[model samples]
Target chain A: DAGITQSPRHKVTETGTPVTLRCHQTENHRYMYWYRQDPGHGLRLIHYSYGVKDTDKGEVSDGYSVSRSKTEDFLLTLESATSSQTSVYFCATYRDPANTGELFFGEGSRLTVL
Target chain B: GESVGLHLPTLSVQEGDNSIINCAYSNSASDYFIWYKQESGKGPQFIIDIRSNMDKRQGQRVTVLLNKTVKHLSLQIAATQPGDSAVYFCAEIPSSGNTGKLIFGQGTTLQVKP
Candidate 1:
């Protein structure tokens, strides 16, 4: 199963509200990534972590932040949710960086901001 | 923005037929490319990957073709099935770094009709 799960499969929220999406993996992968998929933008990376407590911003990291305090848990937080931020968020993990074998992904979390 | 595909190109194919989805990348230094499939309300799942050193790679029912000369990549699905209806994305990894930062292209939506 690769063992990756995202909490709150579907959520409807209000604008300016704070939301957090959690990604947990039983594999204890070293790399974790957060991405948002929109209608035409494909999937844009928000943030990623290479190791515990080490993270970096992705191309579309303006309104989003991420924290990875453990090997199996990565959290994506929205300081203030907006309508434009409504999209399907996905979390992925990898065992190795050099190996392009595969990135195990979660089922995805769908968020709609009203 | 190094490379962006705002308008995702689409391909419609009949069931039992073959399907091909193409992508063009910007970074010539990218050494690894991957193909992912994302069904409705789900995260992108790994399909296949090809390295810049190799031109083609095959999976059980899928093949990935990489043209380093034109910086183009294509994914071919043999015997398109109804379950293959999904959005497909192509991602590239920089050659120099081992960072888990992957540059993704706008995904192509494949519609398989019976």
Candidate 2:
């Protein structure tokens, strides 16, 4: 079973357009994290959620925003797409609130800003 | 500027031969570390993990070794195969303590020659 799933597996958008990627989980994990993967940068965290309605910034959260309305869903939004934001986005979840070491990740969402 | 880093960007090994990928971390207080493998067009998958208290851990045909003195980590794959060709990354918890965050390293690509 897929514990976590990301929507819009592949998306191509233009600059200045708004885009939203959805992450849904069936495991009911209390913590959710959004990350972007680039060629040489490996994976950089964008934002993370500790609980419903609670979110925090990460290493590269300057151009991204995230919202967790429910325990099983976390949404990432790009106000305006930029060429620098073209990347493969991944969503991860963990069951323990204190243990963020072991994370279960989703397949990923590839976003291309053209 | 303290982050996890890898020794090489790519490594080519013949099939049925042994392969080793190395990493170094700046955080001396980081007690928990994890290794992840990512194939092309896919999100990273967790391979194994090690703690500072322990020097080594084994999983199937893979082994992870932690050298706290040198702040180094290595992953060894026995009898490498084509399926093992992927990018490997090392991640560690912040030295400030476990605040539910992980710092990922620049990935090292392992190519298994047929």
Who wins the lDDT comparison?
2
Q: Which digits, one per residue and each the tens of the lDDT, describe model 2 over residues B1-113?
A: 76999999999999999999999999888868899998888778888988778899999999999999999999999999999999999999776755546789989999999
Q: Candidate 1: where is the Cα deviation over 4 Å?
A: B4-8
Candidate 2 structure quality by residue, lDDT tens digits, A1-114: 347989999999999999999999998878889999998898999999989999999999987999999999999999999999999999988667454367788889999999
Instruction: Rate residue A88 of model 2 by lDDT.
Output: 94
Chain B only: TM-score of model 2? 0.95
Residue runs of model 2 more than 4 Å from their true location after superposition: A97-100, B95-100
- The alpha-carbon RMSD over the true interface for every model, in angstroms, is 1.5, 1.7
lDDT of each: 0.86, 0.89
Candidate 1 clashing pairs, residues 3+ apart or interchain: none
- RMSD of every candidate to native, in Å, equals 1.8, 1.5
**What would you estimate as the lDDT of candidate 1?**
0.86
* Docking quality category of candidate 2 according to DockQ thresholds: medium
